[model samples]
Target: MGAPELMRVSVFKRYLDELAPLDESDPHQLPPSLLQDLRRFKEHGRHTEPLEVLAASMRHLRNVAMHLQDGERVLPLTLFPRQCLAHCPLSLHELLQLPLDNLQVLHVEPAVLRPPGDPQRGLVKALHLYHPLPLLSWEFAMRGSREQLLPEIAGYAAYRASAVLDLRPLPIPTPLRNCVRRLQRETTSLRQLSEWPGLDRAVASRLLNALYLQAGLIVSRSHPAADTDGWF
Candidate 1:
């Protein structure tokens, strides 16, 4: 059928819940004992002798839940630069220092604001920046290892300059088309996919399929196609 009805957040959540473990080992899964302990810790007084240890254990459990929850919550594919940054705070410098594999998504506000100097190393797989400052001149880093930067920069700029720029995917340029394709192949979740610019319904559908297939979230009826060339 035409792009299997856009998968809903609830569906994705259900998938996540199924895959996650119910204990301290898996944030998605919670063991009965751990759950009981967490509840007890929350209810007990702070001055109790065992309170410190219990609170520490609870904190660790909460962290795991928070991480898994972060993975489960999918932001809209068309998130603005400011929104992304606000949701996931990290300075460009701090982000650059992170291992490439560790960098999930980079959200830039006014994605159009290019960092000074030519783009260098330490580019993440997905980037989202805002565009168009009224006073500042809008410029894109057209050349670099991080080529995706240009479109992300440009898309934000175009959006800010005028309201007319179509954020939806409808005959997008080859560069962005290729970028979306790469993201589809490399990323594993919708949360990861939402980091890029210009992801419309078509792109989102393809990405959901890729993630489901790659993660074994869905079983294939027949031999899975080796090539997914034109889905974008």
Candidate 2:
């Protein structure tokens, strides 16, 4: 006998429900207001799911969904997807090679971080930033300062223990390559990473920013038992 489709779909369904900003009596449906918020979240890049703030927000939405009365013909939020724990360097490397105009295309309908309850599926989510990557790269490469692009790294020392580094084999600069290899030994903090022998703290910060801008770096997964280190 075949497994029921719901069994195959339960995980995905659970994902959508968690991503919804509001709750519906149906559990599977989202309200128009929540849908509008998601659009704003996409434009502003506030759609990460691995942070407690977002989880809290979704919980709030679920509370709202629970009180809904009527239904609409609006599309399900599932049409716009997201990826979690992406292999960003290789992805960026390939993307950087594309033409500027092509890079301007918005590839992901919209992607966000995965919530806490999901299994540790390896690099399974489709990248939502693929479309905006090229443009972001250009902006980051040209006018972007490290501080402007990423301010969270300054406070990263506190939660480095929760950070996971899943690296892809790519030709990165020697110093950065060494840092990634060292992270594989154990979970590391920004403070600790700053003290590596012969590696400049600035270099480490640069590497982190580079990987992050490309969506290569994986932040700590949010868990009530464990600190999520606040999604950067």
Candidate 3:
């Protein structure tokens, strides 16, 4: 005997069904329409990108911050996969690193502030923005109104020499050994970084995308350095 058998998955499911009333008939599933994501993902019916959604959300949060009344405070919104609602959330360092190829991202906006004492606030399961980061590196998750390219950071391939990247305020990725010594001192465009570093275009592109969300590296679309040469 295997130390007393536990309930089967089917049996556990039955227990779950019994826990909820059949009359209610609520599927308890998030609506696909509620999904917020980049136009590219939605156009292709692809999975939502967590960092893209989060970085975008941070811009909206700034508006919420502006509306704060005297003594009112901005509450941290929790970001996580639809299925993995944890107790609390703040920073999205881990969320940014999620395997987002097939997962739906969801967030919780605080509703209790308006109602003052809504009991539902606690019932809701789903729940910032920049700093010096010497104490916290690799934490760009910036809150600002800016645009970026590269649909996915892990393997984004659309690198252009014209796109200027500023890593002065950010930590260097360990793979590129001298990134700290060179990139941190001044901003460099994609072309310069690749040629000087002797980095393959693809590797350099990945580096650019990884830093896209952080405020430190704003690819100035209007800047003379902006990439116009069809994707590298």
Model 3 stretches with alpha carbons more than 4 Å out: 1-37, 62-77, 80-148, 151-177, 184-187, 196-198, 221-224, 229-232
Whole-model alpha-carbon lDDT for candidate 1: 0.28
lDDT of each prediction vs. the true structure? 0.28, 0.36, 0.36
Q: Model 1: per-residue lDDT, tens digit, 104-141?
A: 22111112222223174242123432212110000101
Highest TM-score, which number? 3
State the lDDT at 52 in candidate 3. 51
- Deviation in Å, model 1, residue 183 alpha carbon: 47
* Candidate 3, poorest ten consecutive residues by summed lDDT: 62-71
Count of steric clashes across candidates, in order: 17, 10, 2
Question: Which consecutive 10 residues in model 2 have the weakest lDDT in total?
Answer: 65-74
RMSD of each: 21.4, 14.2, 12.6
Off by over 4 Å in 2: 1-144, 147-149, 156-170, 214-232
Which is the better candidate, 2 or 3, if ranked by lDDT? 3
